[model samples]
Target: MIIITAILQMLRNGFVLSKTVIFIWGLVLSHALVSNGVVDVFADFLGDEKYNLWKAIMVKSFLEGLSAVLKVAVIHVSEAYIGRFKAIIFCTGSFTMGLVLLWIRASHLDIVTLIFAIVLIALGTAGKEPTLRDFFDYQLREKVKKNCTEKNEGEDKEPSQEKERSGKNDSAATNLWWSTASIIGSVIASFFLSSDHWGENFEISSIVMGATCLLFIIGIFCYYPEEKPSESPLTIPYRVFKAAIKNRRLSYPSSKQDYNNEDSDDASSEDFFYRTENGEVHLLPRHPSFSLFLDRAAMMNNSDDEEKVRKEEVCTVVQVRDVKNFCLIIPLVVTLFSYNLVSTSGNTYFVLQASTLSSYNIGAFDVSIMALFAIKSLITFVVRTIQSRYKVVRPLWSIAVGMFFSVLCCIAAWQVERRRLYLKKPDDDIPMSIMILTPQYFLLGLMEGFAEGGLKNFLSDRLYSESMKNFVEPYIEMLLGIGKFSSILFALVFYKWIKDEINHSRLDNYFLVLASLSFVYLGIYIFYAKFKFQRRRVAVPAETIQETIERMDELLQVEVDINQ
Candidate 1:
């Protein structure tokens, strides 16, 4: 449906560069090839009869979690030091290098290649991913903004309908390409991993990655619009923390001089608001308690040192407010763990369960158990089309829908595992068909389609400003890592349930406990969503009062559209 929309929109509104679709295809391919490909890769270790099976699976989770941790550091360097474009170049280069190493690992099958390849692939893609997603929207927005400005300056005073149309088309086109890649990649990987030709799959993956990277780089110069990176939002917190430490002994200043100008932040507003990367001026919800302490970090000091006076000008006011909001947003970001946990299980335990099931051959091709993840992706192919038509009205609601799907997946898995165990004879192989796991995989695909995107929207779309989100974006990505790592801990705590053979382990019990935990997590999420974040009108920054007023209506409309 989304693909159809893109074609029709292109036909009606004319067209864009063919390379635009190609560029989007390359980006989506980079994302898709590894979206959950590692599960199969780890399953290969078990199939090869190499290391201990369960440990190999845990290693995969650990490496993924570690890569997620590295994502934060890499993004920090990208956003804070090198420009995002350059960071992507460096990261993509790393990712490509990882792919080459992964190909070598596939060919040789050794510990050295194995460890280095997975880490670099995981690390490089982790850095590229969140930035790539953000950059995609960022460049499109800048292009549309420039077009509108140019058109408005002319006599007609109309917006650039072409650029606006292009934005809509690009959004649809990207979704279409991403779904196409997921389906093709999943099917191809599943087919290849089932046989001795799995190494060829890696070889093919590496080659495609190289070409895509080249196209992505070329498109940047010739096709995509150029926009300079904003000053990193992260600098604010660094300065605030540094100042807080220096002024540690100082009491929370209560004087009027300590506060920012009322006009800068609309101090009279009942509550505070934040926004996306290119968002309106925002004020964070203030806490009378710790906020006063953060205030000292920005407030004028008693000492009239020349350096202090100069630094205070840049660091006070907006910086502290953003930092306070950062503090407030942390808990919400942490609340995202349940979805991450469910997602990790999709890649880890689901693959394990599928590996243990009986395989049915289709004509000449033997579709392996690992292809179950592909089934999940195939479901995603359908879900993305449906999702485009009816977006969730609120960020919280999107999250709720996603989490609900995840909980259902857990329940379904619990039932399936119990059934598989029940029918198994004491001394014979389990006779369950791979098709038996289809429902749970479908549930997982639904969870993947909605939950992750919903979580991202809450942060990068509505809850953060351009400067503010840079601080939290990587951490939010960390939820993926945290979930994977926690799986290791969960395995340790419930060691009896994770073993070389699913039939031996109490996996049904494990899934049931997981379902119960998910229910609790969902309850917690609902509790926080009810009281934690609220929308209210906010004031512009001290520096942009006039420009902000001109943009306020547009900003409000953006917020309204996001909610409904």
Candidate 2:
């Protein structure tokens, strides 16, 4: 719900959705219909009949965490090889297969089948995330380009036509319609599969998953094909790493004259570093910080043959700088894992805590835990809207504020748990109203609004190379997966001491521990943001490059005509 809500808000703020994004969201909505309601029920079933509560919790966490890891691995390996549309198709197909297996397991009450299905579902769901994000980003860039072109052309147009033709409002509305469809699908599924209708839940969920697969197939042609690099995308990074190591001991030029000396007189004046025998530029100017040794890959030796140098050194300075760019952002990315660790607790332990409280009645219907997620989503949307309107654009500052709220969320949970423990008797319902948990949920939503948006903006703006931009989504997803996996491990270790039984559990202590970690992480992030990180220079516009090429082509054609 948080993720869906965030994407919708982003769309409203002019973010675009491609067919890949729509297909991925469809699969997600299908999975949510099953997982959100069924997983808890499945866990309860196991706890009540087959296993202990701790074991059930471990089983659920392990499947989810392992799935996340596998998802990252698959995306990292396959994203370069496959187109985004094909990847979506493959992932959605996997999801459909997993749903089939899940249906079988549910019907037969077979634990082994259930376990296998869980693994398959994890794999399918994991791969879709980064791919969908990349597609959305691409579409967003296209939208920005269109808007820029329109603004440039608006000067010559009549005011009425210009107003009528503005793409911004139309684009936003289109994105909103897609987001609304996604939300509506999830809500419909949730209504059919919620606790009140547990008996037919798996059957309904399987049908939804099948329908989602068909929907994805229908939209396969809707997205524009992502541009494929002429050379293998991985080649540059691999060559950079290899060259950095191979040239580690080489001495760099000591003077400006040495740096400027070239083996060939015909080298292009635009070349920042050495030029190849074939007239290709080899490098750009080196970055000033971290991984400075990579610059040695571009250093020219006085005795070296130009052809031999070209053959031996395949990396460009731009590629080396790209690697360095990732190095600079490592600290910030690592800090996010800490925030993710705290966030994981919300989905697992916080839900458990909420389940124990007296249910809130909305007239005839008692509000389920899933409904609380809607409340959080609503709050996040409101917060994001306000931020967008004010143009409060400091991402790092927003992330810092989010971290602070995360700490407060933990503190709130700890206090509530402490109170519940003090007030409740054995076998008695929790004396506190479920609404007491509302503040934590609201704070979490606010934290997500600030932190996630800030991180996305910061990384996208700071990355230098076009190729490197593709990596931002996978890298963030990897961190999130690791955070969830690590949190589960942390919980397991603490479980020996804290136990899983609600009556005897010291879960408040766990929340306190996370609160402390969040506080420490916030301090470290602040220090890194202030003193250590340096933003890369903005990349040249692709449109400008394309125009220059077109102009050169026109001049060449004119020269040919004159010669004829």
Candidate 3:
């Protein structure tokens, strides 16, 4: 009876959680619809008024800036002495409220009305993410710093220049070069694929694909191990950028008088730590390393305690540091083609295979795709749960395997397409089994599960040592926006080139491209894993419990050294 009661209670809680997720999803969906609608309306109005492309661009940019300003203003208002959680809830509420207005007006459907409504909703949603992130990071920083020291009396001091070297310096030039090459190739591919005179003008698409593959090969050759640098004494970039940016001012001290006034007392360095204007309190560590400086800053909202301090503070800060190279650009760009390839793979097979299969319904909206996604989500949840229990298996391995499976699914689809084309069935409704589509979607979902989970953990692990770690949360959110934008680039390119000629064979070829790309990506990741330290563990001295206690007692009695 107790077990039954507990099960009932758990079911109730699950339902509540489901309702909350659905509500949030609906709100986001509504916002997207409204925002896009508004953009379309504005573009139409500009076109009607004969505004040139440059003028339209300027106007859009100005509107975006105005939206940003308004969002920032709201953040400041909400941030006034409020807790981080409250600030985030307030911002999310504001955006949701705007979305609610659009949902209320679902009865009316005019281009101008839709446009204005969406713009208003978007304004409420835009910049809220970054602002909320800033609030969270601010809270985390304070909580972590507070856990180290009990003193609320003095500010924390800045670490020295040597400490700043803990973070990795990924070469921005390499990233930029690779990203540029990919972009140029994409453009060339787009041109060749879209042009009707493809045979005469150029077979540029094939050439671009070949070049991109070559670039990946070159990256493998050029890669080299980076030497680990010695630990620094000081924490660099003491001032958090968000605070400075929010206030719209530089944080540098104005004069020597200001510096002296700030740290007025010259106490014994060993007796008392000096706190800087920023929240950091710096002191020398109790060892021989001159370059080692200890920073004791309160993590926001955390009480001072040893165990909690270890959890809050970054361990092996160098391993987790941020590197701002263009490594992400290629991944971002490739995802566009990847999404396009997967989305169109179904359509391509539909056209090419439908004519051949006698039993299949061609171009039918398989609602099963949605069901499959839900199933995939459930699978991911289970996998993640197991991962929590198991220590060894990482989620990234799943992602790598998922992509490989995707290749297999593509192969299966290609086979179906080839079979249909060759057999030449008499019936118009030649149908392939629904199962053919399942693997593709399942693989995609698996990819999403692994990629999303792994990427978050990877970035979080690395972001702490970044020069701008304090402001990283928001910028990371911004990078997501950039990723989405890159993905959309493929949609535009595909519409331009293959809208008319979207066939099973063409799509088969497309999936082949995606498979090749995924393979190369997997290889690069494997290579990186080989050179990079997977994780760091501290070394402990080996001593029996009895011997250690005896040595401790003797040392207390001033008897002898344990080493001797």
Candidate 4:
């Protein structure tokens, strides 16, 4: 979707596909090839062949969880030192190396080698993914800006309408393209992994990854370089935290008027609330609610040492607001962990379950279990289209809908498992058709598209400062890592309870537990949506306030639509 979007965007702009865009596309393609095509199958192979069912689940889960953590850590530590492009290249190289290692270890079947390969792959993946996403977003923004500039110059009237239409079309095109690529990757990977005619899946994966690395390198020169930040991006959040702590004793202004009344030494300055050291106005107005203490970070304090005061009060109101926005979104982000806990089981337990059921046959070809994931890609396209068509752009509401789907998926899976358990045979395949589980996969995919899309939109839109926006992808990655890690821990407990007793093991019970947990979190999400983040109506002219309220009400209506 991202690759196609960039291509369409370039086409729309009357520019040839830029080298940078191509390189980014290559990165995305390579990622799909490895992640969808190789990794899951390799993990499954190890589990089914080398170890028992429970051990296999643990291996895949542990490797994924650990790798997620490593990726987040590597990105955090290295992103500042190396710019996003370089970081992406570094990750791609690491992943390629890991693939090579996996190929070498294939015959030996050394667990240690496999572990090392997993770690390296994880590190590479973690580093590249967030940076890649941010890069795409950066490109999209630039494209939009360029289009707006052109529209403003070329068409004086209807620029807003044209821009809106163009933006929607471009976004839809990109999403469709991304989904298509993912589906292709999934199908290709499944074929190689499942078919005996394709020499070992690991070998095929290694070759694909190597080619992907080459493509990544080839496109490096084409990328438009972003200016490197003077300070570590990590420092912004830390500075906000420190400044807020320092000003904890300070009191907030009684009213917006009080905030505006404070006179600055510079009479020429018109702005209030927060000013830069050189007396420039900030883009965002002061937000008094939700971590209001952070407002003190931008408050000017009179000190004996002018230099000290300048240094201490340098943080912008926008920056403080950015930090507060992040804080506000943390609870919503944490909800993904619960969603992931249930979702991750799909790749492991669900796949295993499918394998035990009767396969779908189409003449000469038997459908691979991994190919079923294309169902998700399909559902995502449909959902996103419906969303775009109706202008249903409420991200949080989308997330809630996604959560609801996830709960449904769990319930469906539980029922399927319950039936399978009841109809168990000693040595034969389960009587149930693998297609019985298609609904769960479809729901899982819908959950992913909506929840992830919502989360991304929420983070990107809510941020008040452009400077702080780059952190959004990394924050998301960190949250996903946390979720993956937490899921592994939960899986371990569940595995212990079920423990290698294939027939006797009540995996259905685990799914039931997940469904119950999801329900609880869904209710909490509703509460948060309703009470925690209510829109504050700023004091203004009645007409202006009425318009603002109407806009807010429109957004709330979208939420209502999502619930319906």
Evaluated with TM-score, which candidate comes out highest?
Answer: 4
> lDDT at 187 for candidate 2?
60
lDDT of 3 by residue, 1-564 (tens): 543543344344222111222222222333322232332123323333344433333344334434544554444344344533344445444444434443454344344644564455445555344443343233223332333233332546343322221111112222222223323333323222221221222123223223332332343332222223222212222222221233233233222221111222433221222223364332212112221221212212223334543443312212211222112223432433343344333322332232232222336433222233334444444443333334134644544454555565566556655554454344434345534545555665555445444444444443434333333333333344343333234434444323322232244454455567656655665554433323211111235445667877877777445445
RMSD list, candidates in order: 7.8, 9.1, 19.5, 8.4
Highest-lDDT candidate: 4
- In the range 35-124, model 4's lDDT, one tens digit per residue, is 765565554566455466666676677666666666655555555666666777777778878878866666565778877888788776
Which is better, 2 or 3, measured by TM-score? 2
| TM-score list, all predictions | 0.75, 0.73, 0.41, 0.77
Give the C-alpha miss distance for residue 12 in model 3, angstroms.
Answer: 14
Query: In what order do the candidates fall by TM-score, top score first?
Result: 4, 1, 2, 3
Please give the distance, in angstroms, between residue 520's alpha carbon in candidate 4 and its true position after superposition: 2.5
Q: Report residue 341 deviation for candidate 1 (angstroms).
A: 3.7
Q: Write the per-residue lDDT of candidate 1 for residues 1-564, one digit (tens) a residue.
A: 665764465345333234455674575565566554543455544445445646666777777787788887776776667766677777777777876776666646677777777777776677555676666645544554555566566566445565565566555544444456667666656655443455655666667677777887777764454455545656667887778777767654444455344325455342223222233222344532355466556555565744675655425555666677556545755776666667777666776666666787788776565566677776665554445455534556667777788889999999998888888888737788878878888898887667655555555553324567544557666756776777767777788777666667888888898888888888888787775554322333545555666688889999999999
Off-target runs (Cα >4 Å) in candidate 3 are 1-367, 388-391, 395-399, 402-435, 461-481, 491-497, 500-505, 532-564
Pairs with backbone N, CA or C atoms under 3 Å apart (clashes), candidate 1: 275-464, 277-466, 393-563
lDDT of 1 at 556: 96
